[model samples]
Target chain A: MIKYRQELSFKEALTVILYTLLFNTVIAIVLTYFLKPFWENFVFSQCIGILICLCMLMIFRFITTENPLLWLLTILSGLLVGSAGGFILGAFLTEKNPLVYIRQYHEFIRIMSLGLIFGTIITYFFLSRVRISQAEDRIQEEKIKRLTSEKKTVESHLKFLQAQIEPHFLFNTLSNILGLLDTDLTKAKLMLTDFTHYLRLSLAKTRESTTTLSQEIDMIKAYIEIFKARMGERLKYKFEIQDHIGELPFPPMIIQPLVENAIKHGIEPKVEGGEIIISAKKDQDFLRICITDTGLGFIEQNNNGIGLTNIRERLNSLYDDKANFEVMENVPCGTTVKIEVPIVTD
Target chain B: MSQIKAIIADDEKELRTYLKAQLADVWNDLIICGEAKNGPEALNLVDTYQPDIAFLDIRMPGFSGMEVAEKVADRCRIVFVTAHDQYAIKAFENEAVDYILKPVTRDRLKITVTRLKEQIEVSSVPPSDLPAIIERLMAELKANQKTDYLQWIRVSSRDGIRLIPTDEISYFKASDKYTLVVTGDGESLIKKPIKELYRELNPDVFWQIHRGTLVNVNFIDKVSRSLSGRLVLKLKSPPETLTVSRTYKHLFKQM
Candidate 1:
C-alpha cells in the first residue's frame, strides 16, 4: 500500500520511464550481434521486452516489502511474468508457437533475465539510501533546537551578572567632595573635576569588554588619584612596572577592584594606615602582576567578596582554562594578591 | 536661630566627614553632636546623645540604616542617605519622607534642608506614618541588595589549604595535569585545569595572549609591531617580551 502512493509526480515518472526505454533500446541493439536469426527482428523483439519490463514495474507499485526473503520472491515473480510476456509477444510477432519461438531465441531470454536482476537490485539500493538520509535530517534538526535553548539560558545568566555592578564608587567620590565643599571649596572643585574624568573613563571602559594594558593602568591611576585626594596622608601607593608592557590588552575594572580590596581589608583596619605596592613582571611564558599592602595580613573570617568570584568566572569564560589568580600573606604584616595570565602579545 | 543637634551615621569614615561638612554648609545653625561608622554604633550614639536629627545611610554594617531608623523613630527626625536609584526614592518623595542621593548635590541638599527646617519648626514628626515609611524603604533596600557575585579562591599549598584572593595571581601556566599558581611570594600548583581556571579568573586581569600562556594584562608595558607585521608584547615583569600571533594581533590594532 505504501509503494502504491506516488513518490514521484506524473512528469517526473514520465521522464524516468523515457530514460529507461532509451537505455533498454541501446542494450537490445548490442545483443542482436550474438543472435543471427533475430537480427532482422531485433528492434521489434526489443520493444516487446521493454514493454513487458514496464508492466512488471507497474505491478511493483502495489507491493512493498522490507524483508529480504519477500524482496527476493518479488524479484523472481517479476522476472517470470516479464519473460513469459516476452515469449508470447515474440511468438505473435514471428507467427510461430510460443515454445518454438522461445527455443529459437533462447539467448535473447538470457539477456532479458540479466537486465531484470540488475534493475531490481539498483532500485532497492537507491530507495534505502533515501530512507537513511531522511532519518539523519530529523536527528540534526533536534540537535539544533536543543543547542538554541541552551544558548538562551547562558545568555540570561550573563545578563544577570552584568546587572549587579552599581555606581557605588561614583557616589563615594561625591560624598568625599561634599566634605571638602565647606573646608576648602578650591580642593573640592579639583576633586570634582578628577571625579568627572574618572567617571568618563569608567563609563567608556564599560562600553567595551577588553582594553589595552596602558588604558587600564591609566584608569587605575585615575582611581588612585581620587583616593589620594580623599584620604590625603592615609594612603600611599607605588607602581613598579617593567618597560613596554602597557600596550598589551587587558580587561578593565580588574586593578580597581583589587586596589579597593586592599584598601578596605588590608589597610583600613590598621589605625596607622599602610602602603600599597603594585608591580608587574615577565616570568618565562607568563606576565605576572601583584598588589601588595602593608596592613593586616589575611583574615580567615573575612575571606570572600564579589570581585574575586567575578574575576574567576570571567577568566573561565574568556581563557577557558589558561588563567590563574592567587592571594597570599606579604612578608611581616600585610596581604599580597597576585595574578598570572599567559603572555598574549596581541 | 536655635541650634539643632544632629548625628551622621555611615560606614565610610570619609562619607561621615563629607556628610557633616555638607550639612554645615546647607544649615549653618545645625551642630554635629556625634558621628557613627556603623548602624549599631549609630543607634548607641542616638541613645546616648539624643540628637534632634539623624542622617542614616540606608546600608551599614551592624543593624542596617532601616533598623536604626525604626529604633530611633520617636526621638529624632530622619533623613535617609541612599545610593539606590528610582523605585524606593519615588516612595520617599511620595510620602514626604526626606531622602538624599549620594554626592548630595547642593541644589538637592538645599531643598531637603528647607523642608526639614519647616517640619521641625511646625511640630514633631507624626508618629503614625514613621513605621510604614520605614517598612516600605526597608523592603526596597532588601530587594536592591540581593545582587551578589563570587569573591574568593581556595588554593592548596605546602602551608596547608590557603584561601588566595583571585586578584593576587600574576599568571597561570600549564604544568602537566595542573596549572601553576604564580603569586608575588612564590608559585603553587593547583589541580584545576587551565581552561577551567580561565573561566573562573576575572577576564579583566588575566588575558590569554598565547595558546599556552595567560599574561596579566595589568603588567603589560608596551606592544611593538615589527617591520614584518609581527607583534611582540613587553611586560613590567623581568626582561621578557611575548610574541603576539596572528590570531591575537587585533587586540593591539585599536590601541
Candidate 2:
C-alpha cells in the first residue's frame, strides 16, 4: 500500500475512473428501468450521464500521482472508447428516433470528457501529494537510521574501549608483576594468580553490554592489586559503596580510567604514592562515584589526558548531562575527582 | 618435549610491547620468539621465528590475524585476539581453538596458554580445519567489513550495459517493467529484479524496504508510519522518502 501510494500512475488512475464511470452508467440505466415510465423522459437520460461524470471526478482524487503521458493516452482512450460504447448503447435504446439518438450521442461524449478531464486533473493533484509524502517518510527514516547507527557505534566504541583498556590494563599490571618477578617471585606469583582470576571475570563480562556494580568493583579490586604491587608501600586506596546499588547496571569499563586517574594524578605524582580513594555511592536516582586522589591535581596546562577526557566523553554521551564530574583541590593539597551517573537498575 | 615457540601479532605498539614484556614474567617453559606490529610484519616474523603459536589481531593492516595464520596453517596453532563479534568469533570457536579479547588480561592469557598447551599435548584439533576456518574468517571479513559500493550491479544507457558502482547510485525506483537506477548526474534503466539485486548487493549497504525497491541502507534515515501501520524511510541529502513492506517488518526494529 505504501509503494502503491508513492508510485500511483495516471494510466492506472484513468483506468479506475473509466471503469467507475461505466459501472455508474450501467447502474443508472438499471434504476431507470425500475422507475415509473411516465416520469422517465429525456431529463432522466441526461441525469444518468451526469451521474457517470460525478463518479469519474471522485475517482480522480484517489490516484493523483499518475504519469502525465500515460494518463493523457488513457484519458483519450477512455473518451474514444466510452463514446463508442455510448453510441452502441444509444443505437439499441433510441433506435426509433434518430433525433433522440443524435442528442443522446452528443450528451454521452460530453459526460466521457467530464470524467476524463476532471479525473486527470484531480489525480495529478493527489499524486503530487504522494510524492511529497514519500519524500517526508524517507527523510524521517534516514534520521532514525543515523541515530540507531550512532547508538551502535557508541555501544561498539564502549566495547572497544573495554577491549582496548582491559588488556592494556592487564598487561600493565603484568608488567608491574614482572618488575617484582626478579625482586619478589612469590609476591609476583600471587599477583599473577589474582590477576588471572580478575581477567577471567573481566573477559567473561566482555560480551555483555552492562554488568552489576559489585561485579565491576570486584574487577577493580583485582586491578588495584597490580597497582598495589607497583606502588608497593607508597600507595593507599579504599573502596566505599552502598549495599543497595550493587545490582545497578553500568557499562563495561566505567571504572577503567578513574583508577588510572587515581594512579596517574593521585598516586604517581607523589614521592611517597599518595592515598587514592575509589568510592561508589547511591544517590536518590543515581550512582555517585568519587575517585579522589591525595596527590597533584590535574595539571591545568595538560587538560586533555586521554583517560580523563575519554571517561568524561563516554559518560556525557552515555548519560547525556545526567553524569556529574568534579575535579577540585583536595582538603590539604591533592586533587579529588568526583563522578556520578544514573545506576542501571535490575 | 621440545619447547613451544610463540609470537605476538598486534596493531597497537603498546599492546605488543606490553604483551612481550609480560610474557617474559611467566611461561618460563615457552620461548618468547618475536613480535610483529601488523599482520604482514607478523607473517614475516613467522617466517623468521617459525613459532609454534601465533597470537593474531583480527583487525590489522595488510593482513588480518586470520590471514597470517593461514601462511603458518599447519605449523602453528592460532589464538585470535578480537574485539568480539559473533561473525568473527565463530571462526575460532568452531575450530575448537580460542581467542583473547583485547585488553589482554594476565589471567585470560594464562587460560588461553593453558588451552594452547593442552591442544599441543594431545594433538586434538585437526590441522585440516585451518583452511576452512581461514575461509570462514575471510567470508566474515567480507560480511562485517562494510563497503561504499555495490557488489554485482549492471547499469544500462544508450551506450549499453555498464555495471555501475554501488556508491555512484543515488536512488532506485521500479517503473512499469524496468528499475531505474538514479545517480547524482543521471539515471540508468536496468532490467533487474529488486529481489535479485538484494541477494547480490551487500545487505550491509543496500536495504530492502518495499517490494518494488531496494535502498542503500546508508541512504535511509528512519522508518515511520503515515496513517495506521504503514512504514517509510526518510533519506539523506537529496532527501527522498521510501516505503517498507509488510514482509520485512522485523528489519526496522528500532524505527
Candidate 3:
C-alpha cells in the first residue's frame, strides 16, 4: 500500500466550495457582459450548477484514489447529474417548463454537449493533479524505506564487527598468552601465532560479504585454538568435513559466531567445560553446518542472545527463505546449532 | 604476624599457576592454601580452608566470581580477577571493591597486595560492607543482563486480543497445546506452550513448580506439606493450591 486520504476533511471541503463559488461567479459575470443573459439569472444558474455537483459528490462520496477507470466514471456521473439539475432549475426560473426546450432536440443536445465538454476538462485537470501528487507520495515513501533499510544494514554490520573484535576475548586471549610465556614457551608462541591468525581473519573477513568454507574453517580453527590454549584440558574440539565441501562458498563470520557462542555460553559455563563438534555435510541441494557442544544443557534464553539473533538476521537477509538457522538441545546435555543454506553447484 | 592464608580460583590452570607465582614473588609470607578451577570449587575451597583472602576470577564455570563472593563475603576478602568486564569493573570502582585485570602483572599484584595487607592488619573481622556491596553489584549485573524477559503477554479475550502484563499473572499451567495464564480475575489460554513460556519469563519471578506449572513468586502465599507428604504452594490472589513435583521439590527446600 500506497494509501491516500479517503475522506475530505471539513477544511478541504470548505476550500473546495469557496473555489467553486469564485470560479462560477467569474463565469457568470463574463456571460452577463458578453452573452447578454440576465446577470441574476446567469449567477443563479451558475450557483445551481456548482451546488448540484457538490450535492452529487456528497451523496456518492466518489473521489477515487486507486482505480483511474472508476475515477473517470465517477466524474462523468457527477457532471451528468449536476448539468441536468442545473438546466432544469434554470429553465423553471426563466420559463414555465424545461420540456419546452427538450422538444427542440438540437438545441438541448448543443447545451448538454457544451456542459459535458467543460465538465470533463475541469475534472481531468483535477484528476491529473491528484495522480501526480499520489505518484510523488509513493516515490517519497519508497526512498524513506530504502534509506532506513540501508541504515539498518550499516548499523548491523558495525555491531557484527564489534562482536567479532570483542575486547573481552582479545584481552583474555592476551592474558592467556602472557601466562603461558613463563611456563610453556613453545605453547605460548603457538597461541600467539593462532591469535594473530584469528585477528587477521576476523578483520579481513568482516569487510567482505563472502568467503570459502575452507577460509572460514581456517579462521574458526584459529579461534578454537586460542580458546583451547586458554581453557586447556577443559576444552576439546573436533572438526568433521570432507575435502571438497571446503571449497564451497559460504558467508564469512557465520560459523565462527556459533562456535564462539558454544564456547562462551555452553562450554565455558560448565564446570567440566566439554567438547565442541563442528561438522558440515551436503543434504541434496542444501549445505548443512552443525555445531554441537557437550556442556551445560540448552538454556532457553541463550537462543535470544545477540550473537545468535545476529546470525539469524544475517541469514534471513542473505537468503530470504532459502537458508535456515536452528537451535536444539543436544542429546543428554548441551546445545546444537545448525545452519542450512542452498547450494549453487556452479 | 600470623601467616595469612589465601586461595586462588580461576578456570584456567595456567592463570592460577601464574597468579601463584606472582603472589609468591610479591607477598612471600602469604600462604597459598588451595586452588580452585571453577566457582563451586572456589566456594568449597573457601569453606574448607577458611582462607583470609580469595583471589577469584569474575567469570568461572557453575557460578560467576560475583556469586561466589556474595556467599562468602563475610568469611573472606574478595579480589576479583577479570579479563575485561566494563560493567563489573565500573561496579567494583563505585563500591571500592578490589579487582585486578587479567594478564596479571607483578606491578598490579603488588598494589593489590599492599592494600590487602593494610586491610588484613586493620581488622581481623571481614568488612561488614563487603556483602552489601557485592549484593548491589550482583543486582546491577543481573538488571543489565535481564532485559529480554517477557513483560507483556498477548492473549485473546472475549472481546478481542488483550495484552496482559506478565506481572499480573499468578501462574501458568499447561493444557494440551496451549498454556493457561491464570490471574486474580480469570484465566486466559495462550498458544505458547509452558516450556516456551518458562524460557521467556524471568526465572527469578516465575518458578517451575511442576512439569506443567510455573508460578509467579510474588503471588505465592505459603508452602505447606500435603497429607501425601508432597510440597504444595498456596497463592494469595487466585486462592488456589498447586502441587509441587518431586523433581522441583528442591526449590522449596529453603522455605
Give the best candidate by DockQ: 3
Residues A293-324 of candidate 1: C-alpha lDDT, one tens digit per residue: 88766553244555665655565445554777
- Stronger candidate by TM-score (2 vs 3): 3
RMSD in Å for model 1 = 18.1
Tens digit of lDDT per residue, candidate 3, span A66-141? 7656655665777887777777776676654778877887856755664566556655555566678779967986
True contacts kept of 2: 0.01
Q: Would candidate 2 be rated incorrect, acceptable, medium or high by CAPRI criteria?
A: incorrect
List each candidate's DockQ score: 0.16, 0.03, 0.20
**lDDT value, candidate 1, whole model:** 0.68
Best-to-worst order by TM-score is 3, 1, 2
In model 2 chain A, the worst 10-residue window by lDDT is: A38-47
Q: Give one digit per residue, the lDDT tens place, for model 1 in B58-151.
A: 7665566778998888778899897665666776777778889887777888998998888878875545667777777777666765322223
TM-score of each: 0.50, 0.42, 0.70
lDDT tens readout by residue for model 3, B1-255: 688999999998888988998899999989999999999999999999999999999989988899999999999999999989999899889889999998888999999999999998999768998899899999898887747788666666543344455767899999998899998767889999988989989999999999999999999976877535678787877878898999999998888
- Positional deviation of residue B142's Cα in model 3 after best superposition, in angstroms: 3.9
The worst-scoring run of ten residues by lDDT in candidate 1 chain A lies at A1-10
